[model samples]
Target: MADKSTNNIELKVLVDKESNKVIFIEPENDFVDVLFSFMTIPMGTIIRLARKHSDPVVIGCMNNLYASVENIDEQKFWIDICKDMLLHPCNAADHHCNLLKLKLDDAEPRRYFMCWYTSSCKFLSYDRNTSSPCHGGVMDREKSLRLDPSQVGNVFVKGEIRFTVTDDLQVIPPIASTNYVFTKLDVMDVDATEELTINIGTVEMLNLLMTSLVSKTPLTETLLKPKQEPKLSSSKIINQAIHIESQMFGDPMDGDEEGKISVKLVVSKSKKMVCYAEAGEDFVSLLFSFLTLPLGFILKNMKDGSLRGCISHLYKTIRDLDGQYMISNHHNEMILDPKLVPGFCYKNSLLGIEETSYYLVNNMLTTDRSLISTEPSQLKVIGKKDDSALGFLKGPAMFVVTDNLVVRPISRILELHILKDLNVPVTDIEDQIVHVGKKEALHLLLSSFLCDSVLTNTFVADLREPKQEQ
Candidate 1:
């Protein structure tokens, strides 16, 4: 591995422009345990769901301190290795992990746990040994740095939580309460920046292993939510933030190899008077909800709540207000700037006579976000009735093809595929096929939207429902 600084353009340090690449990684890079390997357990539990909170998996990690050096030699060695090398399995870093250092409060059997281990995203910094950081970190040998974001870690499902913290490392903002890291206490409660004393390669390996062990258990919406009350006050939110990070759990395995990864619980700095609003909601409501709080006192409190990104239900009154809601690429600590996004509902007639633009933000389907181009002519995609005819399939909404024409269940992916297949961009919104002849345009739109259905002669039957004769 060579230094990235070797890339010299002009006299400037082209750190920003030149991409960083890693030259090599050793030790076979395998993060997952080989078959029959006595790896720490984090398997078999299903951890389905997102934006969830639950009790921590508790393991008597204090027993770890008891079984040191003399008792479990390899375990002790790894623990020492972790503390010294950092991210070494079970070594110097045992106390910091949420899984192993928690205190058990419940009387449940020591069978499984909910605590799953995940690491921060791939961290890159100047390393004297490497020119690029593109090295993969998984292999059967060495097992030093486990940095792959997608790797799964050992699973500890269904255990009660027991926590232990050290007095060392000089915790910035200081530890608050017995098991809480409040927003008021630290800005890094949700995000942190600091220098770590460990080889970058080694840290990557550990991250890979830790993330692999994060439980992939099946969790439902029922399990993802807490039975307790919702909407905590600023003080309570802060008080509850620190202890949210839990460590260690018991791994119970089923036959399946891949399971669910649980979303980690986190807290961030907010204002004294925190406001919650949905996408496409009124901006004045949001502003009044938040701004009405004394700005002097709000900034003075410094941190209390987190401004949630993409509340989904937020609706701003104007385009300007909507622009402030879309800033997902966060850039600051004091204030969170939301991405500019406007919501739309075809049924509400948000579109005008022509050339109205809107964002169709789906709660599902995250990948391949692209801009869609369609003509003024519309296509109607009808949802079929179930076999029993008990109810109609609640299909996707309508799309406008002409000023007065509209069609339901217009697939966005279909348009993209058509463009790709036809080898040309859609150049116009108004169709020459309208009035002159709607047949060709309708054929193109329908064929593109309804994948795999062959149309014979492109003729649609007139099946409009007519008024009953008196």
Candidate 2:
């Protein structure tokens, strides 16, 4: 069984004496398990944890998006649980991460919920407070679940194996000699290098997760350097302008593949910046869906797999790592491309992500011992039949998405307040119609990862470019 009592993982880091840079880290399987777990974290979970810590790490415009969900009134959503889902998103690899030496994700253990009258109503829910559709009854009765120990043991990488992790977060076996490793890192003078041992607890793990998302050198920033002041919200970073020259990732939009929603971008005439967007439920839902995506899924969709931070390198390592080094085939495969947890995926999502088909062992779904069976029943979806539309917001409503991605219901007074806040005159602001297909959706995702002015950078910056004379 994996050691669940350990609080920290010890790591040996090599640092350059002159530049004070981390060369590489020699970590055991436990530490590697922590590294691999970064891929399994949902985007919303990352933002939530960042805000929880004393020194919060700003992850692009996610802070604004998360705040939008919080600031919006509970009555605006389809149900109360919709807001709960965004604020505390679930990780698909929760069970796998429970076996790690250090647990960074603090989400409550997965609980099983079913209708109060389970004998007659077969509906199941992850949230106990959800109102049942059958009888408007609360699905608060908890059911005991039995997990197979053998299936989840020995997490991530194999034990008794030595590995070398680069400062940029590349994992490789230590097949080469120490001198050869030094040569690869360009360490000519061994006297200039020093070794240090550090303990990685939950705090440091959270710091590493934040740093890895923004900085290229995570180990050096997380360990050697002092903590930087927290940039808690997007409002703090919205003053600066950034231009990201990146190739579009998805296929070109055809007539049939065009977007269902047409967002109106309000741009500044003089500054050439997007102030905000006037959109309906469909566009807001698209932005909200980003929180549900696993890190691996977003990285996989990017054809080139290049982002602002070292996450791309980590993804490549998962793809390149040999199967022999992993604990099990299932372990390696799941980490490479994780899916959204059940009930969280949108059916007509523009990004084209799907939730995994989850089923419970019906025989063990009951708490009573007498009801248990020697032979388990066939796997079932354990809930009311989903009609393919599992969304967070109600329809026919308008919302305002600011440059920083703060979302709120649209109002005439609010529009005037925003214009006054930006000192933007009505004459200076021009509206542009933009269609959000797969390609534009991918660009928005990329900008949200790297830029602070998400709406301006993703939609407005392109309009300023000179058109080619075809």
**Top-TM-score structure, candidate number:** 2
Q: Residue 304 of candidate 2: its Cα lDDT? A: 48
Residue ranges of candidate 2 with Cα displaced over 4 Å: 1-6, 113-153, 176-180, 229-253, 257-259, 303-308, 359-390, 461-470
lDDT of 2 by residue, 167-268 (tens): 888776766687887787888888999999987777777787787766678888888884673452333333122233422213333456344567888888
**Per-residue lDDT of 415 in model 1:** 45
Best candidate according to lDDT:
2
Clashing pairs in 2: none
lDDT of 1 by residue, 71-145 (tens): 322332212322211111111111111222121111122111111111211212112222222233321111122
TM-score of each: 0.14, 0.80
With candidate 1 superimposed using the best TM-score fit, by how many Å does residue 468's alpha carbon deviate from the native?
Answer: 60
lDDT of 1 at 439: 25
User: What lDDT score belongs to each candidate, Candidate 1 first?
Assistant: 0.18, 0.71
Q: Number of clashes in every candidate structure?
A: 92, 0
